[model samples]
Target: MEDPSLYFPLPTIKTLLQTFYSSFLFCFLRVFPLCLALLFETLVLVHKWSFLGHLLFVSAVVLYTTLVYHFSRPAPVYLVDFACYKPPSHLQVPLHSFMEHSSRFGCFEKESVEFMGRVIKLSGQGERTSLPPALHYIPPRTGHLDSVEEAHMILFSVMEDLLAKTRVNPSEIDVLVVNCSGFCPSPSLSSMVMHRFKLRDNVKTFSLGGMGCGAGVIAVDVAQTLLKLCSGAQAVVLSTEIMSTGWYSGKERKKLMLNCLFRMGGSAALLQSGPQAARVAKYQLRHMVRTHMGASDRGYFSAMREEDSEGITGVSLERDLMQVAGEILRMNIGALGSRVLPLSEKFWYSFSLFHKRFLDPKTEIYVPNFKLVIHHFCIPPSGKALLRELGKGLRLKKVDLEPALMTLHRFGNQSSSSLWYELAYMEAKGRVKRGDRVWQLGTGSGPKCNSAIWECISPVNPLAKVGSDPAGPWFDCIDEYPIAMDDF
Candidate 1:
């Protein structure tokens, strides 16, 4: 007979262990009556008094499996907080300096430089942080080599800090998931983390790349599933964007926007399963919603990497990025709201949207009160316009969107890591509290919209004392944020 476990739906397990679980479940479900009959027969064959002994044996086995077995599941997964990197003060690049660099280097024409300047000013990045020694060195600010090194520097630093803060040994980590949108090189980012941390040889590692900025949430979703499927597993998820490799050094006018938007940032989050970790965990994973609107051809190619006429490689942003982002957000919210919203809210939302769609396409579709379900928002700081657009679409207020705006103004677009930085901002300001629900929205290429929900179980613990880290992006500037950086 074929091993039924090979046909199981989960992709997490190894082939050797495939039959172990599937066979157990299949046999247990199908032969429970036979087992009881056999027990009774064994009791009769041995002695009439053996019935109580067999029952006691079965009870002990059940107790041991539930209480003592390490892989025994039905365990809850937990988010044990996370760490966001705050590069040194020297790495800060103000708008003036960046624009000057663009103009001086001839990376952009005068008109292109002006376009970039406007983009930077409207970008809401007050003093964007960058990985040191790369942009600081010379005119060709970033390169392919710098990308790998930057990943090593930031990923290792953040991972070390995370493991140190949580006191979890690298070997104790059973799995590792890394998400880097523009840079997934040989050996993979996940493998790099495994090697750097000296993790166990058999540690399961997965690296996600080219999934766009929303890849972070996607990685979290992957980690969440892995932890639940494989009992007793602990995962470390690293979210980051290495702008060095993705730097648009070319003279393409349309592609120059990428030069202004991306900044260097990364985050490391420790997630685990089991009762032991749940005790000290900071948050509980509630629901994760992901939507990739690939069918929309315009949206799919809204952001992409391609070679210019000059043979210079860069990522080009479509003119309709904001519109595409809005569409993705609408779809994502439609899906997410249904799962988490209260019954009344869901009913009202469905009725409103349905009526608007079928009865009156021109009528206003009621936007559900996301605030009623989610207390805190962690929208990725992709850019200012996109941020405002997403907020308005969700009926999110200024305060609700403050954390994301503040993160952008201070750190620029950290890509996948922007969500974590926003989360850090909320904590630093003492806005997060136990029982508060946080929803993170990420928009990226493939026009993907990704969101994850977390319920805070512990109080906020800032890495730097209320904006005290000398290297912290918000150290001297957080108070000035949520200010109208909109010059338009």
Candidate 2:
């Protein structure tokens, strides 16, 4: 079927225009009386009182109409329900080794090294020697049906779990959006999901691949769009990285980083505009900003590296990955500010900019402090340096970053799931209260960056906490944070 997002009226664009025009009209009318009074004075001085009265009547009518329209229009309310997210039981490979190895690449000072050693001592697990026999059995570099079968095994397990928790039937989902950065083949991931789940023929489905980490928010954006067109239509979103296909066989340090950092992870989410879901976690997806920086081979080469002479493909991040990431994050923030950022923040940022550019010629405006507006934060599993750079740039505190660090220590970088894990951590710790906001930032190939802002609703569900369900036993102890590679 045709992609649902292709046809829906984009509310983001519409809202942007609406806000711009409203602000423009307000300013235009506000200045009109002053301009008109000047004109009237000039006319009276020139002995043209009749013309002044005519202009005054016209301006008054226009100002009145603008005020009435502005006051009458109400703000839009988007209600997003969180369906249960369950990863396949089979794909659970704990991430101590991955976390240890990935963290090493970025500025491994004595403390971080000591921290890694502590994690190793705490987990008491050896380095990941090999994949399970089942995974290893798949012949190298050939995309086959077995890959799909394995993908299905991973997909269905999560789907079934979600269906059970939500009490939603497999056949009832009206829109299916699946985003898998790897292992995409003919018939697409969405079609495969639909076929495997036996979704109705009428269900609309879209498969988004090759979009890397930012795809999760891209999926959320697509779901938000689909929710608007069909009343009662529920959208199911699946985000996963197919490690089975992208496994790096080369011993290159860059290639090995992927092997070390990325693990098998997938998340299933259900979004619906229907009132039933409105009573749930109510994620009013206010804004999404997507910025793509790398179009040329040079720019693309900056973010993505594939280390095979035999044409095998996998992401090999360069040493300066975080530097590229910070640039993209800044670009995305600039685009998003016009839409999602509060006027208070805009005023502060703009004031700083004016002060730096015009008044203080020598000083550059510091990036506006995002810590105050940020309710919770999630950064990807690039490394400690990346996290530290982001914190320093954004002026985030230890408490602001601790939940994310804790999640990475426990879960490794589950790619797209990393943000969800961080969110889960906050919920577990009871840091996310009613009316709190969350900023989810993502980075990926195409040298891209994307962000989504979620405002908390009235209720924070306890059941959504990680390690609280039947899967709790799989997680290691939560008391002392996992400290990998500390030489005590």
Candidate 3:
């Protein structure tokens, strides 16, 4: 894909008119209040009203303004804590061992085995990444029962850890969201969580499937929206992909890519609303932006799950996958920049747009420096190539890209839960500080991209608490990281 920073669309006449109208309405609302206050003062002076009457009128205006401001603002959402599941050592699949097992399975042709081996060798995944117990079987048991076991193992483990870390009782949860892109059983994952945790009877539960890896951020957005309708509500978002059922036994090269990349992992996050939660929260929600490009054929099919020619089902990543990702990411960040960028950054971007559109059509448009607002980034680590491309497009330094690269090396691609693992890595290293802003960017099979901005509200040091809880994904291996990307 070409550099996405150069692809800003020119403003159309209709969009310009809408912008003008909105700006006028905002100004009118502000000026209207002042105009009414002035008119009341004029009446007191012209009619020679008593001093007590004027005082009463001024007090009423002040009360009205205070009420309007209080009612118009939305409640703030806080991230109390989050946890990522770390599979037992027995489940780790070393690279060479994976290739040896594939060769002996007898289901794959020699060419297919070679293709997978080559992909894994250059895939940037380390030997410690894990696979489900069912996948470790010689023939791979991909039955419904096996998939259910995988789901329970991951979902329950992450939730248990999260609840323990946050010290939040199950009865206090008012909302539950579970997102797994490839699995949707009869009972639904949300129901399973509620039953296992014995949550309140009236909790709002949501189970989202087939939304792809970006669904993690989508789940956060859903929880935030629901919290706004009630006071002091708590919500939990569980993100995972059940790899047992997602495995493909086919030989098609496109379908085989999934086998080399995805691994077993999951994450659970606790979010709460209101001022009380904010006092103890680690991070405060700042902004969220989502973009979907599935309307066009190229984007919709860029990464899709379908049956191969041999009648075996698997996800096929087309050649245009990178192109679609770049396009959607550009759109998502463009919207986010409008909300979070500093005033100077916005001015330069707008000036460039005007210069390119009217003053000089040949002039290059400016891409806002996101680093000015974002202190840390947790981006999708689908592969090394995609990560490198995104870093270049966003003008990020190598240090800014290390968290994602190291996460991929340590855990492979855990689908929706990968972002949390990256964040956990930062926390374990004590790289996140109070007042820092962390941006999580997620992309998935829908050719969709979503962004979540979080402002750190308190100190986060997982290593300091490791003595009591050795739960961080990188608690054991953080010191070994920042290894040369080439070494992996």
Lowest lDDT sum, 10 consecutive residues, model 1, at 7-16
lDDT, candidate 3, equals 0.87
User: If both were scored by lDDT, which would come out higher, candidate 2 or candidate 3?
Assistant: 3
lDDT tens per residue, model 3, 1-488: 86532333234343344344347575586567778888888899999999986897788788867755654456789999999999889999998889888988878998998998888778788889999999999999889999999999999988988888888888778899999999999899999998899987778999999888899999999999987655467899999999999998988899899899888999999998767788879999999898988898999988889998879899998987877887888889889999999999999999999999999999988988999889999998887877888888888988998999998998999999999999999998889999999999988877888999999999986664421358488877989988897542
lDDT tens readout by residue for model 1, 53-116: 7776667557545532333344578898677777776788887877777677756678887888
Q: What is the lDDT of residue 426 in candidate 2?
A: 66
Clashing pairs in 1: 126-409
Best candidate, TM-score-wise?
A: 3
List the candidate 3 regions with Cα displacement exceeding 4 Å. 1-46, 50-55, 355-364, 464-471
TM-score of each: 0.84, 0.71, 0.89
Which residues of candidate 2, in runs, are more than 4 Å off? 1-146, 274-276, 305-307, 358-362, 464-488
Off by over 4 Å in 1: 1-74, 357-361, 462-488
Better of 1 and 3 by lDDT: 3
Backbone clash numbers for all candidates listed: 1, 12, 0
- How many clashing pairs does model 1 include? 1
Q: Which lDDT values do the candidates have, in the order given?
A: 0.77, 0.63, 0.87
Best-to-worst order by TM-score is: 3, 1, 2
